[model samples]
Target: MVTRRLVLSAGVALATAQLSAAKVFFREHFNDEGWRERWTVPTKWKSESELGEWGWTVGKWHGGDESNKGIQTSQDSRFYGIIAPLDEPFTQDGDLVVQFSVKLEKALDCGGAYIKLLGGEVDMDSFGGDMPYQVMFGPDICGSGNARTHVIFHYAPKNENLLAKTDVRVERDRLTHVYTLHVKADATYEVYIDQTSVRAGRLEDDFAFLPPRQIPDPNVTKPEDWVDERRIRDPAAVKPDGWDDVPKTIPDADAEKPAEWDDAEDGEWEPAQIPNPDYQGPWRAPMIDNPDYKGEWEQPMIDNPDFKEDPLLYRRCDGCTHVGFELWQVTSGTIFDDIIVTDSLPEAFALAEEGWARWKDKEKAMWEEVSKKEKPEMPSFGDEGDDDLDEDMAAAMDEDWTKEEL
Candidate 1:
């Protein structure tokens, strides 16, 4: 027989083992002073450089107030790229979640606040829009089509990618909010905004993961004699007598002749134009079920021979050793912090609860203060105290000011 203490000890050991197994594939709070050593910024960026000013600055501000530290954009119309290595390859298995926080300190007119997960160690110096990436996911607040989080997966040869059809909109205000993308091995995915699940669906259905399951048969075609129209003009119907007698226009009953009008000079000043009520549009026979109607001529669907199903839509980039951010910010001053990639939801949320949660309240209060300051104050009328003049002013103001304007 096993002793009670032995069972308790075994349970404790098991719990500890499980907790230890929960690992963070990659994380960068940028709070440490030695962040430059952990991450690499392209040295080829400058105002006169082809990549333009990579105006990225690492500092602390009360806007986000998370750890009093974060990476932010310092100038407008610039390219900012920062890449860092991951502890392990991030594949689509278990529960891969990419989470981060973004605060649009400046109203973003056009810019991307997204991160790219490249497949392997890439030439840091040449990384830009042309670089290949496995996953590019994050919130992007910009012009019309870019006010939501982008969740794109690299499909194949460079430049080929599929974007998630269902994405959640992000707040563009100066308050910090968390964005998370959770993808599983079974092809199902979920997007979260500020710790709340906003969208969830299967990757195959939500995205064009594969070619269509069925396609129109190329061997068949609609017959030329096919009556595709549901209704046709009755051949036996004829126009009623005097149908052409009704004119399209008539003299207006209310329109009076202009006193300065001269019939000889003002080409036919026939009373101001008015609609001819008696006139009816071209007449047509009452629509009846066409006897020869063969219904819609839709080509029959055939099984797509080229279509192939992929059960493992999520695969660990066997060599994806780094994650980076490469984007153009128009307004700039967008702070990014608390970035983490993991295979456990609890682990990801735990990190957020520690970093984001800690300063969210303070950030909220600060934004509220800013809003209070920036918001236009409403105009106030009338005196502070009620006096005889108040009643007199109200009465005097009751007079038609439009007619008495001085």
Candidate 2:
């Protein structure tokens, strides 16, 4: 039963909702002082002097006071690895969902702001990118072409796939936004950005986890003499006389020599050439439908010989033990908070409302205020370029340097 209700506020809708039925695997609000005990940075990351560090803060702005807090990537151009395991291991016997909130407060260029679910023994000291993970869900933004939320499944005996579509972008805003991925036991999945679903489909149709049901027959081949052309030149049409003889350009008849023109000083004066109005472009015979056109040729399809349908595509997720963030960022200031992995949609909604929904407006207001302040003031220069100052720019210099040269 995969379901998502557009919950505006957790207090109003799910205030009495009980989480006992959901069997939560993990939840991290990061509001407690002992949050340091919840997450761990890899030993390799700690020893390396160049790696970025993590910090707990309320970020630039929020609806609440210091209570609104999350773990933030506090440095630039570094690789970070951290993980926090659930109490125990559990199979995907029912619906599995992973969701969280992220605020990309500054330059969010190239980075992996996603969360990973892994199942394995402890090697906390050495955990890094090479660590195997069962599932990875969240946004991965690089640029326009590579911005998207990924829902990956790492199944045993060879299975790995990024969420099946292209350009499934994430919320790239300075303010807070919730990202949720719900994978149902029924083999369908839904990806939500906030309360609305942006993408949803069957697991088989979306991911190439199973072999195709059909394929082109190997025994059958397209005939070499197949008349696949739909149209051809008209044989009955004849070329008009003197079609090629028409000049493409001619001297401007209206143009005249100036009175100061000198035949000796300047090469013999001649009117500039112009496109000949009477000239015809390269002649092409009018095309008529070919009587011998056999339409497009296609190889006959047959049952895929190597295909074997797995009735349990949903089971490919298996399960996970730990959820972590192993990412690389070019420029940091990304804050991650309010993480939860469970089966209850209401619980997810409850957390979203208590966290993101409540603080989003305040965050937006702070963002607007910051953007207004970030506007660059017109720097005064000598009188040379002052005359060239654009009216709008002179009044308010270009805050964005991308539009024109300085």
Candidate 3:
């Protein structure tokens, strides 16, 4: 018989082992002042002073705990680049999950608030738009038609070829919202916002993962004599003799010249033309069964030589080494925080619940409160001192003020 202590010890040991095996690439809440140390700014900002700078804050007004600070873009019409290294390069065999929180307090008229998962050796000091990344996930807003939540991944064989889906869009608001991208080993993917799934599809089926399975044989061409038209004018039908003679318009026979009209004042009067009721449209032979027509000719399909089936198209994910933000904002103030890169979807979701779900209602309440508050009435001209007035205007203003006070 096993003792109770032994069972307790075994339970604790199992839990410890499981914890060690869990794959968490990186997680950041930005709760500590030391967050500045963990992230790096691009070197180009030194020479190019016009570029935006990053600031840490809970925004002008935060919903909940002010301690939950996020990195925000602090300048308008400028570029920004910053990156942070993960605890380790994610190379293990597992699914890829990236998640983060964003707050667009200013509506983000034009800008990108996306985060990139960079692989290989990335020059942290100069990381910008040019640094090749393995995955990019987040929101980008520009004008009317250009607003969307980007879910893109690089094809390693051809870096230029990126897998991008066009379904999900950014949650445009002043509240903190979560964005999650879960790419599974079985070649399926999903994009979730605030724990609710907005888009899901099979990676191999949705994206151009490989060359098509079949194609038209290059050497073969459609025969010149092939009659592919399905319908033609009936040769037996004949046009009516008067079909073309009918006029489209004719003078109204009921019209009589006005009694006041004079020959000298008006040119020869003509009744206004009206649509001819008898007129049919242009004459044409009726369409009938095309008995001699061959069906649409298709080029003979042969097995495509270039297509090589990838049983594991989704498995091509090489993993990520660093998380970076490269952006250009016309209207600044987008906060990014609560980022996570992990192999476990549940872990990412848990963060979403804690970070986003907790603050959503409070933010909404705050927004409604501000919106309902009444604006203060503007004061009249004689209410107070108008120091900027010229000498003559000032004397006249003083006389008006004295009269009003009296």
Candidate 4:
């Protein structure tokens, strides 16, 4: 019989091995005071506010997060961006997952709360709108395409850069929700919002992965002699003999000539015209299926030469050393937290639960509280401050201060 100590030792060893095998390439909760050490903010980053500032702070408390602090945008009309280098690069293989939480405290009229994964050779100091990224993923709200989560992968062909089309429109609200993108090695991708799967499909089918699988045969054309008509007029159908005999216009029975009519001066009198009841519209032969009836013709399909299979379509980025936020906000107050990139989906979800799930309810309650709170009454000009002046001066300046009365 096996000893209990051996079984206990094996269990501990298995657990340790599993932990070591787990690939958590990068993770940030924005909790540490030394967060600046991990993240870098560009010097040229700008805000459209009066101060023209970028308000990016860690350990920021807005009374909506479970933690005492999180990364938040403190002002309106700003472009806030910060980047952190990964410890290791992600190659184009295996599984890849990106997860994060976003809380829109302001009614975002226009904004992009998305993150970019940059390649190893990116210019950290000059990271801006013009900088190219390997992947851009997150929620973007603007105009009619509001609350759409983008999962765009960049592909460079010759001198042009194109993005894959994958947009999953999400519900717009001012509450924290977790957004996750899980891409498997089999070219399949799944998007999860609030731990619920919103989209899932093969990358090759969903995106413009390759040139179309089939194309219309170039040599074949619709021939002029093709008799493809399915219907024809019935030759047996004939019009009635009285068809045209019915007069289109007839004399009105109820109408009488004018009482004081002058025949010579007004020309020969004619009865007022009325619609003839027997009159019918034009007639044509009835239709019937043609004896040579043929079904609708379709252009024959041929194998596309440009179509090529990509087995590593869902693979991770190679030499992707940095991840960052590069976005524009018309009205700010968007908080980002619990950003993680890993090979395991469970780890990403667990990280989201720690921050987003724990505080979303309380954050929603806080929003409701502020919305329902009564506005404080404005102070009257005739109130306490007027007492400092003389009685006559106070009376002259005060008395409701209505412009019409003045």
Candidate 5:
């Protein structure tokens, strides 16, 4: 029989394994040309003397040789390597895992290659150059005093070093040694050297000591406490008396009535005089009011939570009306087309609510049934009587009780 303690221990072990398994999402293998357009070599890495013209290199998998003709060199005789762009955006809730194979040539100084994950910039050169979130790996590859291979972590653009000077070494001329870097969207980063995990910590506070300003672009904005004047519109431009004002009109109550007016007519009657009922003189149909409408008639409510608060909803022009509502599930990566569209919002909400209600009810009923079921009685240790009333005395008492003699 399985004990409760044993079951609980198994559950805890499974949970721990799940947490560790959730570390990375979406790994990109540069085996093809899909990511070629997203990366670029920055000027710092492009200059000579450091690696000078030899900053970066890439090609089809081959045995070690810097002179291999297939290896592509960086532009301007500097680090010549390709940068690949991610197909999707990374958010604070996402995780990225980057793995690469590097075999350094004997002449190649242990400078090691750099892999950077960045946001807020679409282009590679503009990525770490100035952005809100970035992670650099160099100091972690190289060990202290080794100065050859390093894995570094830099946060918030401007290359403000969150971590630096951690030296890493690989077995010399090792073929295709794989390195993995795990980064959480919440500013937590970890480095894995070979198969072992190393250096895991929060990025924001650790990298706070570096210089706040590094990018030289005067036009680019930095993350700071200052207000964004561009986002704030002039109050006068949006005032009621300005563009949004409604023209004043005083109605004359005694104005001439319509030609079909009749005093005796009431309750859904047709006009008294049919001016052109069968004449077919461009008849206009009656308009139906949307039953679910809440706000102004010109602007309808958007039921989708993702787009409800979007500014585009409030910028609609006057006199525009929502004909109907649609729920769309978009599928294509490069197109605005949707895979499915539904006509009713309430139907979706009702279905979701019903599913949740049934699930909760079933769980409650199962637990209640388990509690009510009978359990085996435990042996009682309440009495310690008549140890000596055994053997012959017990036999004589049993016979007397059977014969009704005492």
Candidate 6:
């Protein structure tokens, strides 16, 4: 009875374990095109303001200058400012994902993109000023001449300030690649570059927060409110530190130089274009989708098997290979694949490597292709499955089965 009870308990435990292991949740893709239509752009936010805020335009794609063909906005700045209402206020508990598509005519300096979440008051200038949130793809700076472009992921909280930046470069000249970000409220936040899991971590606790300021009184102007007179020590007197007391130097005799001085007869001095450092490609947010929940689905890699094998050959023939290359990530016993392609690999790699070197003085990994070889297949389970059973029966027969049958 005791042995039977123990066996029953063990069986029940094993059944429960199987049931738990079977439950799995695959990520959903969220679309930016659909999301943009659902959100509104705030007032006082001009489409193209004097402060160079034109990059904050809304809509699917707003074509820009000829030089930046296929770009939604100017290459000089980051594009799109999306303001949407959440059904429930964002907290540190729920999961959220944001994705989009971007292309570069050619990479530019300080040119990169990111998605910032704001829970409290959001100041666009500060990129989520006082919000308790994270940025999936944070801002990045492109190296001089690299044209590598791909999706990048930045895990929030942990990547607070400038340290939180990770990017995956895609093949050059590809358009409309998909990218995804997975953010769970309490658990680890993950960023998939293309579809590759590039980063995962907890939210950092040391976010900088400023004290709230009181609204200025409209009826009476305070000293600080009056811009011109606020700093006046006396109404009729100017302090030594005031602008009037400061020495203003006039141009000397030789100050009036030629507008095009020291030219080589052609024009102003043109610095030689420096090759882009490795891994300095511009980062883009790819597309996301969230259709009805399906059982543990996997996103297939947009195949470019001959990417490195025939770089120039495929770059001209296949646009997909030209635009980006795929990436792979292993998480929770599952593998996720993504792609990164830019207009230029040699350029983007140089830029990414340069940026990495600036932050940390480490040498970038040299690109190499491992030789592939074929191997013989091993026997399947069916071929060997009956061996153990046959051996056991032979032993039993030798010991007593023959005598019993006789």
- Highest-lDDT candidate: 3
Evaluated with TM-score, which candidate comes out highest? 2
How do the residues 1-406 of candidate 3 rate in per-residue lDDT, one tens digit apiece?
4698899999888766655666888999888888889999888544577678888988765676889898999887889888999999886366888999998765576789999988888889888887788788899877555678988777866555455645476787667788999988888898998888988988766667667789999999988899888889999999999888999999999999998878787977888999999999898899987998889998999999998877657753475789989888876778998999888787787677787787788888886675454333322445457654344433322222222210
> How accurate locally is residue 92 in candidate 1, as Cα lDDT from 0 to 100?
54
Which 10-residue window of candidate 2 scores lowest in summed lDDT?
Answer: 397-406
Query: How does candidate 3 score on lDDT?
Result: 0.78
Clashing pairs in 4: none
Per-residue CA lDDT of candidate 6, range 355-387, in tens?
Answer: 322322111111111001212232222454565
The runs of at least 3 residues in candidate 4 whose Cα sits more than 4 Å from the true structure, single-residue gaps closed, are 1-20, 45-68, 145-147, 157-166, 223-232, 244-281, 286-291, 374-406
**Model 4 RMSD in angstroms:** 11.6
Ranking by TM-score: 2, 3, 1, 4, 5, 6
Model 6 whole-model lDDT (C-alpha atoms): 0.31
Error of 4 at 150 (Å): 1.0
Candidate 2's C-alpha lDDT? Answer: 0.77
Worst 10 residues of 4 by lDDT: 397-406
TM accuracy, model 3: 0.77
Better of 1 and 2 by TM-score: 2
lDDT by residue for model 5 (168-264), tens: 4443331233344555555455555443565666543334433332333444454454333333333334323342232233334345666676657
User: In candidate 1, what residue range of length 10 has the lowest lDDT sum?
Assistant: 397-406
Which pairs clash in model 1? 91-316, 119-320
User: lDDT for each of the candidates?
Assistant: 0.72, 0.77, 0.78, 0.71, 0.34, 0.31
State the lDDT at 189 in candidate 2: 86
User: Which lDDT tens digits does candidate 4 get at residues 190-260?
Assistant: 99999999999887777765678899999899776676888899988889887877888899988888988
Per-residue lDDT for 234-261 in model 2, tens only?
8888889999999999999999999999
Candidate closer to the true structure by TM-score (higher is better), 1 or 6: 1
Model 1, position 149, has a per-residue lDDT of: 82
For model 1, the superposed segments whose C-alpha errors exceed 4 Å read 1-19, 45-66, 90-93, 157-159, 166-168, 223-226, 234-236, 247-276, 289-294, 375-406
CA lDDT, candidate 3, residue 291: 95
Please provide TM-scores, in order, for all candidate models, with all chains considered together: 0.75, 0.79, 0.77, 0.74, 0.34, 0.30
- Candidate 6 lDDT score at position 222: 38
